[model samples]
Target: MNVTVKYFASLREKLNLSEEQLTLPQGVNQGDQLKAFLCLRGPQWQKVFQETGPLQIAINQERASWQDIFSDNDEIALFPPVTGG
Candidate 1:
């Protein structure tokens, strides 16, 4: 399926990208799976998506969990947890 992946905050800086269009493999249908697939890109990816800290995901503007499935043209945003002071 094709989806738009967006990065925010530190993730955007680290990846040196704000967003991109992704044509994902059939098996990479869930949020967690997508993250794992991205982690394969290199240590930086793994650190941001898997290791560094707690991450938040939203699908088509709604909050989503790791198991959430994606659809064609879906907009997925991944970012670090928000904090306020």
Candidate 2:
């Protein structure tokens, strides 16, 4: 399936990408696995995924869990943990 992946806050700045259309690879059918697949893109992605705390994931605008299965044309938003002073 294909999906739109969006990065927000520091993640967008750090990754140098706001969003992109992704065609999910075989065996990558869940939120967690998708993250792993993205991290495989390069060292920067690896760093982001490794250093960031628990991210807030939204599938099709609704909050989603790591195990949540994705479908075609899903809009996936990844947000960094909210922080405050």
Candidate 3:
């Protein structure tokens, strides 16, 4: 199925693109798995999926657990965690 993946902030700089439309294999049913799958695309993907700081994820504008699931047309976004002073 096809889904739109959006990148924001530092992630955009790292990935070098704002978004991508991909047709993922059927086994990619969860958010974290999707993250791992994207990493397989190359070094950029690896950075985005890094276990450390900066990156955060949302689904249709709401925060998602790393294990949250997704559907064929789901909209996923990647961004850095927000901070306020």
TM-scores of all predicted structures:
0.91, 0.91, 0.86
lDDT, candidate 3, equals: 0.81
Predicted candidate 2 versus true structure: per-residue lDDT over 1-85, tens digit per residue: 8899999998898888999999987888788999999988999899998787789888999988989998989999999877799
Query: Weakest 10 consecutive residues, lDDT, candidate 3?
Result: 47-56
Output candidate 1 Cα RMSD: 1.2
Model 3, range 37-70, lDDT digits (tens) per residue? 8889887667666843756788888899878888
Collision pairs in model 2: none
Instruction: Give candidate 1 misplaced runs (Cα > 4 Å).
Output: none
Off by over 4 Å in 3: 51-54
**Against the unseen true structure, what C-alpha lDDT does each candidate score?**
0.89, 0.90, 0.81
What is the clash tally of candidate 2?
0
lDDT value, candidate 1, whole model: 0.89
lDDT of 1 by residue, 8-80 (tens): 9988998899999999988998888988889888887887665548888999999999899889999999998
